[model samples]
Target: MDKKPNHRLAAHMKEAGASNKGLARRVCEVAARHGEQRGTTHVSVQRWLDGGGIQPQTAAFVAEALSDKLHRTITPTDLGFPGPVPVTPTAGVNYAKSLPEALSVLDGLARLRPEDDPPSELLLTEADVDHAALTWLVSRPDGLSNDSAGSRRVGMRDIAAIRTAAGYFMQLDFQFGGGHAHKAFRHYFREEVLPLLDASYSAKVGTALFGAATEISQLLAWTAYDSGNHTLADRYMMSTLRLTQVVDDRMMGARILANMSHQANYLRQASRAMRLARAAIEGGRAHSTPRGMALFAAHEARALSTVGDHTGAGRAMNEAERFFELADTGDDPEWLSYMDEAELVGEFCHCFRDLGKSREAVHFAERAVSLTDPKYARTLGFCRMVLAQSQLLNGELEAAVTTAGLAVEAGDALQSARFQRYVTDFQHAVSVHASNSTVQQFNEQVRDAMTQMDDE
Candidate 1:
């Protein structure tokens, strides 16, 4: 009888309280128990989960190993197929009576859509996995695969792959909204890609892996930030900072600081934001590409603007613009290359909005919105939200309400908690005109959005 697919591998590993690496180790140990020396690397196991179907011989070996360790008379039949081969003798009782359930869990995880809300059912905590650490930690179990047929060098092919994937995610994020993209993308990073990197990278490969991990972590942070999960966002930001430093990419280090500054700004710690942003700029001065310098300055200006240092902010903005103008069109560093005219304009819009220069904010925001890709729907949505408030401050209540609705609509598909914060800010701004019919209706819409988002 052909049984269900053997999707329980991940779930079984989880119930066994084994990391992917750990499961590989135990599988090897079991192979050893059977007097067969098998080179079971975590990479091999990961590949298995990545739809690399197991071979029949290896399948029986794994099943037997799992059965013996699980203290049961395990057979291939347990894995959902009627075996032509005889059942192997076991030393003890079934160690994993829950294997079938574990398999079900793994099967479910394999099918989960990243865009949908994470299942409330798993009940796993941060303690269950430090997704940030997976890339660096999960690689080769001591006695695993060693088919290093070529020179042990970090190749351009590998770097290109990482860069390509990162670019794809970043573009998707910009046009569709980070909230729309982060959940699914981050899940792949955490569950699939990271583990593969963990098992295969050499030292140079390790550095590149960390770099990619840091970038992806920052993406997750931004998504969390957009959705209003401040604490989670901060955690991801810190983790990214740690990873960037591990890669020793100074430009990326500076960019990570800028990200931290944004979190600080959102938390209303203007002084901290200023300090972080300044550190980012100063840090970049030592090692940044021209574009990195521009990016750093842009972040610093936003921080300075937040604290009413208009003179300093203006100077920083000018410096940023000058550097941006000098940005080379050649091969660029990973982090700094992502900063372009639209991003710089967006930062300026943020500065003006924070500084209470509503008209200037609106002007820069409109420019940013026009230049930003549709993939950046969330960023544009947030920009529109800021623009609406700026218009309201300029005594354009109807425009503010209309734009606020657009912001809400733009963010409708995102899973981020940050939309609530944006809505809350909009509500606070409109409180002065609560009696006005337009403002009242906008408030009602915002409240409903808040309710729906919160339920998720």
Candidate 2:
């Protein structure tokens, strides 16, 4: 069968009065601004118009460019691409509406097979984050009727089992890496947790079940992100946010938004990161404990630093410190108990490093490394890598090489892509000093460790 040409894109292009060349040029310009260097041209646009769909990242840039040119929100769906349709002004952002719609989205996502190819369209964007933020700010507690037609009955024991499984998976992620545990977590969710949602229960039990599932979903998102499956991570997070809204758990919703902010900053979408972090603060303001507030503020600080807003970053950092000082763990959720002084300091290290304050970065990184628990091996390795980078920036080559060696040794035990990235970055930084005996030794150690990982 022949693939049909995308009439929707042809019509939109005609309506916008944009030639193929002009559209391609606009897309390239927009993509460059977003830090994506694409060699898109009129030929590419022609192919897409002829029904050869573009990559998801390019589709996002094209949509933004056309939206700007046409003064409308153009989306990949409007171009007849596969995957979820883009939310319009008339349609709510994905997973931000009522319970049934959210559940439907979740069911569809859960049923989807793991594709070797990238998704056909990019559903999540900066605009989606902004809209979600707005929805969270004005969201109310809408009760979900738990009177299911399913025959199986769910009770507190099932919910307890789910919580225990979440905790166990979370520990694996913390001790090793998300890559080691994300698949297991998803498998458990599909096999053990999904049925509970389908089983019969009262409204109270339903709410509890959703809340538990929401936490698991959040963990799944975190693990997906850690393992470098960013689009999948976004989908999991969207489900988690919807579940939190369904349960009226604003604190968890806020944390999810903050997680989105962190991922955006990591991806270099500074504006989007700042917006999401601010939204997180707004969403959690009434219900979050001081510890949770501090965590949100720390995320905001990192986003501000990424955007070159030094003053704003500093203020947010101070706020985080103040909130942390006032925090009582008893008032915080169990999931948030990990956000202590060590975590705050680690965030401070990241903010200062991004801001080019090597001294500050080294100070906080060292503190974080000392304060972090051994159980958090991945975090400890990351902090050590940060410290090594800061040392290099400060012209302490000997200290830098030694600390980097320690970082590599620590990271060798973990399966985290993030840890590997950090090691790679450290290697790149030390390449200029490769002639040094210490640096050469460090490189050899890294190569051996990488080989060991591959062997395992």
Candidate 3:
């Protein structure tokens, strides 16, 4: 580090209403969010003020934190860093190579729009996901920093507020589906969480803070998936995977891989889905509870079923059930709170339906519907739809139509693109029996529901 007095940085700090400590805190936070834990502190800030040089990447974070504070872009040259400014890409589509770079991509993603040509022009590819997963496995977490900075102390209260709101955001996703569920978390994460990152705290609190951020990112992925914006969801999930390296959260990381598998299955990339599911199972095995293991196994089963691997799918499903049977709710993570017997049964319903086991599909679908809580509005709607599909595929036209009507009415209160897709799929399946009066009535009901959902 060059030990020269940095008048440029000092001048900007004055303009940005930042004290040395405040700037240090922001740098620490910005680095962490991007994927590293840079140990910036008031002392470090004072040293920079004393003309000490920093790494180009660290300089970028300082510039960014100041830019955030001053509400304008600040370059490293402006801060006395004698290096060329990093040319940040227009979006976070590709995996970031460094924390400072990750910060740049995240900033761009937060403000991204259709007008952002480079990123908006780039569609998601399998290479993007494959690279992210491989990077996560190979990445090592940055060493924890005990040093602290910022204007105020950050503690558990701040973390709780973010986590609590995240919990609420998740419930909203479950009840109403993901159409708009991610918005609140986005606002809260940007407004509440980011500011704290700029504040001072122990590394322990920072880890907790980073964990909350990871959760928000993962939730955004799911909500994006729910909205049928699979591309955007992939980007967020890939980002989440990067962050897991920072937090050293193997269990959560594995869960996210399984979610990626779920999305892959939806997109009909069963090959990729199967790979992701196996990766999740392998990675999470050490740290995960039986419930966690069960969840991963269930996802594997679904992917297997999608690829026409009946025996493999059945074997995987059996493992899922076996692990589930050994699960103790007391040992489950908060994220796994939604994965009960009903949820597992729903997975079974889908797999059986895909595997041409209509009898088993209907059986589990009924079990899932019966076991599902009414407040789990979206799950109930999905289970009912699967049940209807199973009935239709089994040549029970009237029963299928009746079940479909129930599904439409049951899901009416929710807005989910996935459910809408399910409705469309069922409609197509029942088209052959269009002459039936019950099928006609169900089609009209579906049209009305679709219209209402679309209008909303």
Candidate 4:
């Protein structure tokens, strides 16, 4: 059967104020910047607008072009495509050999919409991660020569400003969750940081600039992941890893791998998670501080637990603890200063919970809650909810109700969808005991919190 032409593409074309020839020109330009050669013309665009399908690569480029023109995310699906669109391999996954190539991928991702990029394109496979890790393992630092001529000159002040902005965004993300600041951070990176990368700098200044930009890119990825935009998160993480490699920062690369491991586990890609975590350990063994090693091991433990490898998880958890005990806060990277005993205990809570050891889960959850700082509002809420789940599962209904109430209180101050899911999951768990007064009260509190979220 001949398929009908899609009207959505026409509508979006009109919305973007782009004619056939204009859209074709924009797509070719965008594709060329990403190192893809395209021979798209006005006729190709007209065929698309007339309800004929284009090649997957062209479809992706057209979507990017429209997204740029419209200043919002546009997806192939949004254009009424029949199925997942194929993406260029080098779009965000290429491990660039030079700083400029790395920066190009980062800039490309900042402008892309998550839905426009499919999971197959954005998410890393086990083999892909292994190759990346191996590349990092063998790669030497590039000669730090900044001899290129450019219009504007970058300096220490610009680097400091970027670092300061990143720190402020990090604080906001911790307090209110990533959903609150994800868009603003993306805008800041695209509008503020991208321009500086194009400016001239001394080799020393360029190295520092890359370092600062790498950290900010990592933060952007974390916020995007926490905000529930996994596809976007994957793109950002890959870009960050590329930048880390360009700067030859082994510790930062390990952290990025651990993050990829965590995200893989979150998406239920357990075997891939295990591979990535092990890669982090392998790549970081010689260079990382004790605290950094512990972070990587803890991530490995979580991945092991997810796949029901209780013994492996236990060993990894113990290893994480041993390393954490040796950690000196003053000796660690400033980026890793956040990982401590409390964070390790929180990982244990998750590990035990996944292993179905409710009592152990509750014990560590309580300890984590006590040791966690109050400033981490979202983490506190999530930890409390984990405690509540353990309490309920252990048949301590009253305590569960109390603990769940506290989680709701903490969550009320945040705007995170992931946190809301945590609350909602707890609510579902307690609904069987709805007739009890405490359960009833917890339910009411949850209702109130959700209503407040809606109002806000």
Residue 332 accuracy (lDDT) in model 1: 66
At residue 422, candidate 3 shows an lDDT of 89
- For model 2, the superposed segments whose C-alpha errors exceed 4 Å read 1-93, 96-98, 107-123
User: What is the alpha-carbon lDDT of model 4 when measured against the actual structure?
Assistant: 0.79
Per-residue CA lDDT of model 1 for 1-456, tens digit only, reads 122334666555455566657766777787777665556667666665544434344567666666756677666556443233221111001111122221222223223333334333332123222332232132221221233222123454766676677788877766655566766766755543344432444666666665666676677767666655454455455445544544456667678777767777776767777777777777667667778888878878988888888899999999999988888843466655557888899889888988889789889888887887666666777778877878887788898889988888677665555555776788888888889998788777766776776686
lDDT by residue (tens digit), candidate 3, 1-456: 124578898999999889977988999999988876676778778867876535555778999999999999999988887653233342456776655445444443444322222443344566776777777666687543444335457898888887888889899998998875766656665556555654667888888877877787788778878877666676667767777776678889899999999988988889889988988998889879999999999999999999889999999999999999999943776778899999999999999999989999999999999999988888998999999999877878788889879989978757678888888999888888789888889889988887887787
Weakest 10 consecutive residues of candidate 3 by summed lDDT: 112-121
Please give the lDDT score at residue 429 for candidate 1.
Answer: 81
Q: Residue 42 of candidate 1: its Cα lDDT?
A: 70
Sort all candidates by TM-score, best to worst: 3, 2, 4, 1
How high is the CA lDDT of each candidate model? 0.62, 0.80, 0.79, 0.79
**Candidate 1 residue runs with Cα over 4 Å from true position:** 1-159, 175-180, 196-206, 334-338, 447-456
How far is 144's C-alpha from truth in model 2 (Å)? 1.8
Question: Quick one: best TM-score, which candidate?
Answer: 3
Candidate 4 residue-wise lDDT, 342-440, digit = tens: 888988898888888999999999999999898888888888988998888788999988998988987896877678887888889888887999888
lDDT of 2 at 121: 52
The alpha-carbon deviation from the true structure for residue 395 of candidate 1, after best TM-score superposition, in angstroms, is: 2.3
Candidate scoring better on TM-score of 3 and 4: 3
Clashing pairs in 4: 5-51
